[model samples]
Structures are given as structure tokens and as C-alpha cells.
Target: MSNTGAVMQKTLLGWIISGAIADKVVSTSCNLSIDQGLDLKLSKFWDIEEVTSSQNNYTAEEKACEKHFIENYRRNEDGRFIVKLPLKENRQLSLGNSRDLAVKRFYALERKLCQQPTLKTQYTEFINEYVELGHMQRIHETKLHNADTNKSFYFPHHAVIKERGNCANSPP
Candidate 1:
């Protein structure tokens, strides 16, 4: 199962880049910094390093990021969790807003992922795309509606995707 773990890690890495982790992270840190004067600058640059550097080191901030990242990616809808990526600075684009940056990053990533030829790559890319809004759950719902025709993927409710079956039932 080592290979599976490796693949999972790689997939998670892609999701991280797809603004899943970073969006939550940057937003969370900014808020914390603002609320507690926690030196968000240092937190921004240091927190990732701290978590990545040592498996043993676990600060409250670091733990918060880890928890927040997972929850936000699942589209938990925490008000504080949603950091609107900024787009304007002094009337013009600030180039610092996360939402704007995420949009740009996602577009670039989409282009790159589209070029790949493998199912794994395609699935990863698809998941990455949905990460921002928890599309995984929706896909599961769609799968259920068309289960007879499409039997390849099992739509797990726990998946980040939303389930739409409750909206209306289909006839056999």
C-alpha cells in the first residue's frame, strides 16, 4: 500500500496547489494575525515551515491550520474560514487578494491538468477543480442519478462532493 500512500500524498499536494489548502491557510492566518496581533507575517512564513519541518512539532496555530484546511476544503462554510482573495490595492488590484489569486491559479492549473493523459491525472485534476467548492459531493449525487448507466465510480456521501438525490427521485 506504499504506492497508494504515495499517490494519495501526491494528489493532496495537487489539491493544496489548487487553492484548497492555501486559501484556507492564508485567510486563517490573516484573521488570527489581525485578531491577536499574532504577527501574521511571521505566521505566514513560519507556520508552514514549522508543520512541514517536523512531524513532532505541533503549535496551536499549526494545528488550527491543519484542521481548518480540511474543513474548508470540505466546504464547511465557516465565515471566518472563507477569506475573499483580495483583488484591489488603493482602487486598483492589490494583487494580494486571495480569491483573485486563487482564480488565476486555478485557471493556470486547469490548463495544465487538461493536458495530462492518464485517468489518475484526470481524476486528480477533476478533484482539484472541485476542491474550492466541494464539488466531490455533487458528482456523487450525479452518479447516483445515473447509476444504471455509469457504474464506474461509487459516489460516497462522505466525499467532498454534494449529494443531490434528496432533491428528487428518479424512476426505474
Candidate 2:
């Protein structure tokens, strides 16, 4: 699932570069400055290129990330890959609980849904199907008071609706 892509990206970089040889051919890459947002947009850097090819340089943090990945990644019989969350040797996530933000965002979504019935319907159906398929499960009330609150991962989600193409109004 794309949900695991972040972890996969960090892990796979180690594997991809392990046996790589420096290219003898002269080549260049674009040194792009992109906004810190995730979206399904093409890399718009190709049009602008830098004369150098040393863009493969990895930062010290990235090197540590790759090393952590190499040592912790594994695959099971179900073909799902797993790895321990990569934290610096003596570091932990210095963050607060996200439940408040999640609640706020959910209410915002609910407001949006109230204004767009069709979208709301589509989103409801999609979420119902997802739950039915067991991709997600409702957290039991008893476990909501988990002692290790910081270890909980909160994922944000939304439905993408198509308004054009032969796909019609249906979600692709």
C-alpha cells in the first residue's frame, strides 16, 4: 500500500546504492527548490539543469537513515516489508499528542461534506469499503488510553474525486 511508501523510500535507497557504480558519462541534474508538500505532481526540475553530476551526495542524516534502514528491513511470507522506526541513536520524537489536530481536521472535513452531499456520499462509501476489507479497524475504547501515546501514528486521509475524463464523476 502507498501508506508504507515513506518507509519504503528510505529503506530502498540503501539497497539501490549498495552496488551502484559512479557513472563515467557526464550528466547533470536539476537542483530544485520545491515546497514542502506532498502531491502527485511531476518533478518540474528537468527543464533547469546544473552542470554537475554530484547531486547524488547524501547528507549525514540521510546516510544515517540509510544505515538504519539496511539494518532493520525485512520481508515476511505475506510479502509485506517491515522495519523499525528510524530514530537517532539516543533520540525520540519530540512532539505532542495529535488527537486535537485530528479532531479539528475531521470536523473541517465534516463541514466540507455537509456542503457537498455527493462528495460526502462517495467518501462514506469508500471508507465503508475500506473498513469492510479490513484495511483499517476502529480502535477499541478500552485501548484509547494507551500509555505510550507518543508511539501512535496518525494518518490523514481524503477522497479524490474526478470531475473530468471518461472516468466520469466516479472516483478513479
TM-score of each: 0.18, 0.41
Q: For residues 53-130, what per-residue lDDT tens digits would candidate 2 score against the true structure?
A: 543798888878888898999999999989999866767874567766776777888999999999999999988998
Task: Compute the lDDT of residue 43 as modeled in candidate 2.
Answer: 34
Most accurate candidate by TM-score? 2
Maximum-lDDT candidate: 2
Per-residue CA lDDT of model 1 for 1-172, tens digit only, reads 1222211223311222222242233443221113333356557768667745564588866776666666555334554455334333346322332434444665665665567546336557666887867754544556545544322433222123233565567333
All candidates: CA RMSD (Å):
29.0, 22.3
Provide the clashing-pair count of each candidate structure: 14, 0
Q: What Cα-based lDDT does every candidate model obtain?
A: 0.46, 0.66
Count of backbone collisions within predicted model 2: 0
